[model samples]
Target chain A: MARTQGSHSEITGPRVREAAMRLFARHGFAAVSMRQIATEVGVQAGALYNYTPDKQSLLFDLMREHMDALLDAWQQEDPGGTDARARLEAFTRFHIRFNTRRADAVFVSYMELRNLTGENFAAVTELRRIYETRLEEILRAGQDAGVFTLAEPRITAMAVIALLTGVNTWYRDAGRLKLDEVETLYWDMVRRLVGG
Target chain B: MARTQGSHSEITGPRVREAAMRLFARHGFAAVSMRQIATEVGVQAGALYNYTPDKQSLLFDLMREHMDALLDAWQQEDPGGTDARARLEAFTRFHIRFNTRRADAVFVSYMELRNLTGENFAAVTELRRIYETRLEEILRAGQDAGVFTLAEPRITAMAVIALLTGVNTWYRDAGRLKLDEVETLYWDMVRRLVGG
Candidate 1:
């Protein structure tokens, strides 16, 4: 019975989170409710409590998971080397590729940031700062190697991240540029911006 | 009576928009109701119809006004000259300054776009494209003059705008950098970005 219940929760947990993300992304977080999320998951309203304590928790979980996954994915993708330029290129490509595939999550992560509670907001913000620090470190290392010229490593990292993420605003599979071409173009621009 | 009615609407009209913008920025457009907006404006729910037909109209009007204002402001600020580099500099500074002052409208303009009707979305998108085209024109001119190195003028325009507008995400009045310093930093980056 314990094994069956454990298996049931493992399946239901992700479904609940997925449904919540879809609904929250479609409508804003404040507009979506636990009842609506439960409905979307084909469960009773009361059953949602088994997965998340409330709607805020669901939103926070979605955002936290998105950040955590981003950090983890970048960790796995980072081609650590003494060459900061190559690592910066890897990051530019990885950010655009990873974010475009998870457009809805990215959208929710940005749009619903204002809706997170104070504590949740801080948690997500800190995670994002850590991600930005990773890019800053690359820019700083490049500067140290005299391969890049930058006035502010932290600001440049933020600007570069925003520029890459902006791809999601207009990118479509049927669009003129393929993902690979888009990544290359942005990477080139980034390289130029950093004087690398 | 005509003069009084005209004056009343003129005053109430801005008040209504301001209140709606505040509420929409704080809570998502989908979550804010006509009643709540009316309460915020110190008017009866029905009276809001005198200004805007409905919430959708209010949202579209706010977004349209934001775009229109942005375009007008840029036109006024554009230091027209044959020098593409100088023009690009002006645009970099202008965009950062204009957007930071109207953070709420900018936030709503981005966040509530998905909530707009199809027709409204297209209309706002066209206006945004016009704004972007303004930047693309500068990049193209720079490219023609052999001053800026760019593989894609349009894409670079989009990326530059994203980079500049990103100032809104973290800028605060009490931040370490004054507005002038921030603008200078970004302008330098933009110059590097275009190879100007």
Candidate 2:
């Protein structure tokens, strides 16, 4: 019976997470309740507890999963053997491509951070720092190779991340530019920003 | 008498707005109640209604005031007669300086925007656009004068605003870099971004 329940959760868990992220993005974490999430997922409030302990855990799980996926995806896409310029371009395009597709997750990740518990928040921050450090490493390599000129690699990494991530706030699929064109435009901007 | 009550409100209205902004910044708009704001202001819930009709209005009022103050300050600081590069640097530094000073207002302005009614949201967006247009105009002016090379002024303006506004997300007074240093670094990035 426990094995069977685990199998069931493998299916329902993602559904619950999807519902929770949507509601949290729309109504905010503090305003959203477990019952509402249950209603959205077509489960009783009691049954929802089987998947997650409470709303805080639900939120933390969502954010943790987001960070985990982000870091994992970047790890796969990272061009470990490439030169600094090539690696920086890959990271730039990958961030915009990945984040634009998951707008809600990105929004919730940035907005609801204050609602997380101290330990949960620290974990999320660590994951975020790991991601930042990836880009920082690219900058450091470029600086060492004299391909990129920046006063500080860490600060440039943060600024570059902010610039790329800001794309989600205004991008539209139906807009004039295609995603490829946007990637190019942003790449040009970032390339110039670091004196590439 | 109506005149006496109006006179009383004149003094308390700012206090009420200050309390609402603080509470809304601490807890989200949906999570905070009028009673809490009233208590923060040392007034009864019923008395709070005298200044603003409801919670939504209070939120709208706070956002409106923030935007208004932002635009007004930028207007006074805007070097209308200067060239595009000079104007851009002024806007960049002024934005960082002004927004960093009013962190609460900036936080609520970005976070609680979803809680606003359609009309209120539209109003705030309009104010925000007006501000964006100020930067876009400078970009356009630069492009037209053969000084700044950019494909799209509007998108570049949005990107620049995101880059500048992002300082508030990570900047700390006790950190190594002073605010002026930050402004200079960002100005360098922006100047290069536009090929200035």
Candidate 3:
């Protein structure tokens, strides 16, 4: 029986990505070399190439996967057929929870966009726009339905996202506030910001 | 006549700092080299040491100077005899104006903190804490005076700062909204966030 492509890659692909994300987040994309990533993964550089074509591809893949997972996770958490206020609440809680769990991915996604190739950068930016549009749509729905009172959905979306993602900087598992409590505090501010 | 240390350094010091900031912003701090910085400053690598002790010192100095300037600038902007609402409004406007003007310094300040030496990191973090404390104090006064109704002044301060600094990410001089207009919109959201 011949070996399948899946067998060879399934075992190594994830390790390669994990190592790449760690290195990229720690030392940054431009400073990190493929050899360092391979060493981190405990594989030869050639073996690492078998998983990713190059460092740029690895970075693009990590970021793309992060955005894809975020969108997918939000879809699962979207609570369809709900009111705008309820949906907005879901987004607030969901973004903080999802982002805090994947700190490295979140950091790399924000920090390394400048290092991506033009096409890759566009692709990543479009994915980000899709995520932003999801929030904007919710805000727009709220504004139209008279449940939210923000004038500019686009700028409001950006502000809300920034506010929520900022939690990753100071949040600690053993810290003063539990995650749920933190969520409540943030949601209160978010609701107030939009004049709910 | 011997050259005075003050005269030679006054000319080169600012240039060296400028070159380092540009390189650090363009590339990750770890990826930047003293040689590259020296070249950018149009000085020999040996001559670069005359301006700064080492690359770490340069990074530390740049970050420290940025924070110092920020604190100094805010002090000048502070409304000493105003009510909490008036002072809060001043801070909101002042932060956005100051941060946007030094986008490169702001970028490096946030992005390169992980590369700072432990003591250097602590010094920078203390500066950040002082700045955060300033905002928190305003929020506290507002709450005490029954002018603002936020529950957590500390978290609110962090969130507001994040929201304002986020303007750096997407703002363009030629964009539709003027700076004052941007400040107004942010101030509106901010005032609402604090339930004023």
lDDT (tens digit, per residue) of candidate 3 on B1-196: 3334454454367899999999998888989999999778765676777778899999999999999999999999999664999999999999999999999999889888999999999999999999999999999999999999989899999999999999998889999999999999999999999999
lDDT by residue (tens digit), candidate 2, B11-34: 377899888898888778898999
In model 1, where do residues sit more than 4 Å from their true spots? A1-11, B1-11
Candidate 3's clash total is 0
Candidate 2 on A6-31: residue-level lDDT in tens? 44454378899999999998888988
Distance from true position, residue B177, model 2, in Å? 1.0
Better of 2 and 3 by lDDT: 3
Off by over 4 Å in 3: A1-11, B1-11
Across A32-106, the per-residue lDDT of candidate 1 in tens digits comes to: 888888778776676668777888888888899999999999999999988999999999999999999999899
lDDT score of residue B186 within candidate 3: 95
Q: Candidate 1 chain A: minimum summed lDDT over ten consecutive residues — where?
A: A1-10
* DockQ value for model 2: 0.72
Query: How far in Å is the alpha carbon of B143 misplaced in model 1?
Result: 0.7
Error of 1 at A179 (Å): 0.7
lDDT of 1 by residue, B133-185 (tens): 99999999999999888888988999999899899998999999999999999
